[model samples]
Target: MVGRKILDDKHGGKKHLYALNVQYARSEFLKRDDQVLAIRLQQEERLNARKKAAVDIDRARAQAGQDGEPYAEPDPDLDEDVPMDDIAGDNFGSKTIVIHVGSQNLRLGLATDALPKTVPMVIAKKAQRSEADDSEPRPKRIKLDDHAPSEEWFGDEFAKEYIAMAQDFKVSRRANKRRVLPNSRELVTKWNSTTPPETIPEHSDPLRIDWTELPANEKAAPDYIVGAAALRIPERSRPRYHLYWPVRHGWLNEKDYAGRNMLERDFFLILEDSIKHELGLTHRREWSQYSCVFVIPDLYEKVMVGMVLQEFLRDFGFQRVCFIQESLAATFGAGFGIACIVDIGAQKTSISCVEDGMIMEESRINMKYGGYDVTETFVKMMLFDRFHYADFNLMRRHDFLLAEELKGGFTTMSDENISVQMYDFHLRAHGQNTRKYTFKIYDEGVLAPMGYFRPAIFDHSDKLSGRHHLIPRSTDLYNGHPNDPLSKAQMAVISYVNQAIPSAVTAPSAQPVRPLATPVAPTPTKNRPLGIPSHLNGDNDPTPRSSPAASPPPDDGGTPHPTGDDLNGDEIGELKGAQPDTEIIDRTVPVMPLEQAILTSIHHASGMDERKRRDLLGSIMLIGGASKTPYLGQYLEMKLRAALPQYPKEILVAPPPRELDPAVLVWKGGSVFGKLRMTNDSWISPLEYDRLGSRILHYKCIWHW
Candidate 1:
């Protein structure tokens, strides 16, 4: 007896043979015929349809004067047998979930309909125009996966491609369109007989398929679920919980402090306080365990993320949380793509490059330098140079705290000129003579280092050549004349040029000159001897024109001017003769020379070698609250040009908060990374996680490349 096996004809009809068990059938059926029954059945209904299609094809071919070949019948053995159990179960229409996790934040979205809403689709990723254009001052770099697509995987197109690939493999789906079936089941059977059977065919009705064990490519659709475990839990199992609070610095929380402004205190302290407060105020005796995954796939970003989140969570009611770095999460997020995440924050800087988002520990680069450094340098320069009128001593006295105030107030030239009023006064200190000092009483651009990172008064001026007086005098006196602009700008340009040059020679120490007898100078007019100019001039003077008579300085350093007779040659002494050459070279004028050592430092600091350049490029990220300093980007651009002379690609900087607060970029980056949807389909489950635990935790880092 044939088991529950199915058969079909190429014409379209299908038949399922359900034979009784031999033992059971013996008692039920009296007549037993051991034979292949040739029961006459109607030709497939699809034959009519096929005939119509054939007729149409013939008419078209005849109209085009082209003959058509006869169709061949398909082999019956090609019909595949599917286990009955494999062909049954489940509904297609269901709610879909969209989840996003980043290093800094986590967001979940749901879509009942086929399309996801705007909120779920928008992921936070920012790239700066300046970095792309190669306009940044310091062009640092990071190495990225060579095979990673240059274009990002974003938007509907990215999802569409995945869907198309899924469809090609014939996993049942109604992608962007609905799938239709004919009224007759015979047509389907006939079609199934001819078409190759898929383990899971595209046309299998939802009622006949299991949702679990779907291919990832097909499962990636919006309608598919993640872990489906989330769906099993009752909606009332957990209540909606929201805890929103400002985060503080981790350092502050670690070292407790008593201050009037609690918000300004350590972040950890705030989190701690919040948790304590929650315990005191809330009715619940316990809460869910707070297991945090620190996505520090990059050392710097990890440290930063750890610090910030630790502080932020301290205030929460939840305790006993686990922390996993975001870098690892990113690995799970991207599936197979390698990536580099350069996290630039207000106080910290981190660069993590991963072969697959999970950074290999050996490859991370975390540096102390960040946006704050850039701001500090610019703020000091502003207070000391332009605003202070080159009085660096006074500027030096201004502390970082005070300088921040000035920077916040006086950012632009107009702001400095209009708002800042410096008063010059003499003050006595410690019974010493009173000293004169200038104080900036008011200014707006005087902000902390955070403010100068992006846009600022002075963009990228390599310490205006020290040769130029710290500040141009005319800078303080801007006349309405058009020449004033030209003159002042010219002075600034010259100052820059002179400052850049190195001073090779120093002036000789002052020395007393010996007195000599009053000497007569040779006269010019072709009468003086060729060597007369050298003979007549004093040793100290570079220019010694031959004329009539001029006397060397007396013992008291007194000298006399020369006349025409002194410039004349010896023939002139005879009363009349041709003048000898009396040309004098001016040695008093001096040009500054280049400082090789400092220039070398600048070049070296810039990405010089290809490996180092690539390394630097890989790590280059805009950071710090102060990165907004005007033209800071240009300064970095100039430096990169000097540093990485070989690489043609421009260094890219992450865009800051001009559109939004750039300071939050790292945070946003982390938040987005943390929220990545990593299900059992893409990542190892807790059980398998244990299997790979040793390999991951004790993962050996390859240092060589």
Candidate 2:
């Protein structure tokens, strides 16, 4: 019975399948479906719409052109009125020229604009034609005085050209060697060392000339290549060319005359280019209409300031020139009054404490630990530890640049292992191979910046003991003899007090019960005249009592007595005698760790005022390029909070506004300051500078004053 049931089920399934197949075949043969035709029609309509839209756009554009109102595309990056546009108008009164001169970059802009223009703080010499090219007529040069004007290149234009030429040289070698070349444009070599050499023909080709056989006269003048171009020249040729860095560690490089000359030349060109080309002010007469504000480092010497002022006044002939401290300007730019500003620059990190819009001079610390040091440390670690590359001489400027890029890239990632392909690096072990080397950079790459926070990571022979002293050596406490007259005075007071104390306890008082006689007639002193009746003396009398002096107030071990000038001569003498003759034990240590440096600065600035210290610590402003490092602000805040555990845990580390840049915070602040009408007093006119000399800056500059 089971077998018979199974056979019957199988037969029913086969019959059902046959019925479904027959039905599907019947449906396919029924008709052409409307759904398929509808889809096809929709696609056709979409194509026609697109074509019509294109035609309509072209027609509209043509019509707009015919009407003499051609369509102008709106730039998303620019505001309603750019700097150039604003300069064209007659409303130059509200505008100001703001310049922030940094060690690495230059930031310049009009106060009315939203952001400043940034350019490399570098100047390169324009390529000079060789003696062989003397036959060619020279182009007319722009003259500033009786002397012929020297050719120069400023900022990004020279940088771009240099980098392009360098890369072209690199590619040219590979192409000449029959190696795989990078996809670059056709090489065009310009004469007099200004451009890259043309692509070398095959050895068999007649056009191919062996560069090694070239005569000394035919060779490019190494001195002609300046700025970034200097990096591309062969090592042997670099000596002839002078690569001048006008500013180092945020001040004029006073070590040599060349640095000073380069600084002046670059500054002059920058002003000329901005006025003549950028703002379309060709005539020299138009320069007087504009006021300039220059942002300088906080720790600049007075002589440097004077030099800069002199240059601007004598050379550029600006109507007015103002100087602002970088830290103070950054504080204002960040929109904060009291803050601990940590500016990590390319070559140095300057920590300063600002309170109520004024810089606390005593609490400033400048150190040579910053982004450049971090890159150098990373490069060293990579060379010695990771790759073990023996040939350090082979490492070019581009290698360090690539290392910097790698360091920046490492900051943005959380991965422990960062794989970098250094195409330019030539590993001696992998001799003559064109293959790129891949390095797995781990802890060294990620923790290179740690040295900035931890000074011990770097080798320093002189161990710093206490808080670093930023004050000049001449005015320092330990500068003179330890047993100076001040110390002697303190000792004399102590000896006098010791001798008088025992006698005062043992000696009997002369005229003991004479209180009634004193009440009868009290002598009046100059501070309190006898003309005023006792009844006239109200509840509040600022003046001291004229009657015979009462016994000294008993010590309550609370607050110290007010040390004001109102104290009588006798009282002042007694107070001076009471002071101990203890030496000031110069406990200040030098070259402190970054964290301690910050805390010590605040401690010194605040002194015994706990409230002031707390206020400063509450608002820590971290600015500069180094501050852009990942987790730097957070790490600093963590360490700061840990060091100052007594303060509230939630200390606010205020960063610059999201729209602003930390590296250019000072520039932005300068721009803001220049725009405001209230800051007009800060501007120092050329006439005032000329009349009073550079000393006028000391008075006009609020921070300096």
Candidate 3:
């Protein structure tokens, strides 16, 4: 029964999927007076019955003089292995791998696995020593060829080395301080005995050392560090090491080649390591057998970037590769076909509408409001309110981490004034002192995440101008005053049409208007269609014909015969007359608020008629780590409902499942999809790609078009 309930909730219930007679009902049972009263009486009677039954059971037990064994209720919460019949059949023999590379994380695992192994998508360069340190003896290099290659560290191992180096520096500094004190005292005594006390040299304060700059190695060598290790570097040492993020705002950073290369190298290493770890394979040849699927943001489909990524993967020895949109993957993972996905990622938020496995690209909106933006807002608010004395540059990382913790804690609270204690050593007055400072966050904690839904509160003053291009202006022909010239012209045209209708029906017979003596035929131009002169072929026709042709006589109206040339000319005139003269708006508009952004995207999706729009408005799904902000789904639902109040009450706001991490849903969905035999057609084999080129992706990936 428990398994059935879980399956029903996830798969939308068998009835919901197959019911043929589903009806829309909006009756309010609670509003009926008799029904309400009956419900109250029924609740009271049930409570009394439960109490009476408990009393009778106690009396019976007492009469029995002690039961052989106390009846124990079944443990509903106890773990139970789901029967094979209830679980999806496993096809582990298939050689497929799924990888989801997000702005914040990289997830990879086999299709048979329920989840993917995730790592941070960041790379840090190890700090390099100053040129002065070159004179020092260097560690012996391991020669692999004519010259030994420089050693490099990545992932967790790189972080461990940096941390250990920091620890050693701290311990050595403390020992140096202890030795300096006694030596200074001895020097003072000697000066007092040998020379006058007043002549003794004043003891210089211990020199302030920059621990972050201390060389970790004899030679000034820098290596790249990646994943969680990059984030573990000490705050002070961060400036010395260059941090590189390969992907930002759901796309590869094209401007920085070095950083981009480091990111690529890290990805390669991570992929190779993941395959070895998950599949338990050691040889490189074993990797060639598996196919790979990557889930990327929808924006990548706009350009040649997706093809570039495919080529990159091909270089990595994957036999086959497939691409899936992040939003579509999340919708599929959640077991839904039609949904408006709002993916709040680390650096950006993406809102897209998907229906029947097809993404509405026109309705997709990507904005620069996301989890990091919230953190930045929190930091700014704290600095403005309490930490005015501290340097923002030095305290940024420390406060960012603190703000993250505060956001998580405050999200669970209901109070308006929430105080959080944050400690930072950077707040110390002097290098010698180790003092901690506490920062108290108030309303800003809640206000920061709320910006996602009500962005007007957080938006810049310049951006708050509600100038929409679609809103019709008074200057528009339809909206103009009756006396305005444009309106008067339209009125004149309408009056002419009305008069022409009656005149044509009641007027006496009129003489036929003669066509102008065919203008002196211009000299024929070579290469013109049908040997017609360019001047007479509509390109440079001097005389403009404005009047409509006379209506045919009533007897001839049904069988009016016109020349092909006359028909062509009349059709051209009608086509030109049908077009409107509205000016096109410029594309350089400022960013919009989150609410307007979502609505604007929905408005532009192709084939979205009234019913489809209403259906999309009814199903909005919020996913990603940033979307986990408390009450976000409810807030979005309220705003969306208000935006389209005419929609049915069935509209729902699907928040990420509490039992699973929202950030990894794309990966999970990719895993599920990758395991299916139908997905085989989606995979672009290396040979196929080589033969057809990148155009094949347009057909294989549903979101590409």
- The lDDT leader among the candidates is 2
TM-scores of the candidates in the order shown: 0.29, 0.53, 0.53
lDDT of 3: 0.47
Off by over 4 Å in 3: 1-94, 127-222, 235-240, 255-283, 301-313, 392-400, 411-435, 454-590, 606-608
C-alpha local distance difference test of each model: 0.28, 0.48, 0.47
The runs of at least 3 residues in candidate 2 whose Cα sits more than 4 Å from the true structure, single-residue gaps closed, are 1-95, 126-240, 254-285, 386-396, 411-435, 459-591
| lDDT tens digits by residue: candidate 1, 501-620 | 222112322443232223345333333221222222111111221111111112212211111223223221211221211110000111111111112211222312335435434434
Candidate 1: minimum summed lDDT over ten consecutive residues — where? 580-589
Q: Residue by residue across 593-638, what tens digits does model 2's lDDT show?
A: 4665676566546755668877887878889987788777776786
Tens-place lDDT digits, model 3, residues 82-103 = 2111112335226777887766
Pairs in steric clash, model 2: 466-589, 467-589
TM-score of 2: 0.53
Winner on TM-score (1 vs 2): 2
Q: Rank the candidates by lDDT, best first.
A: 2, 3, 1
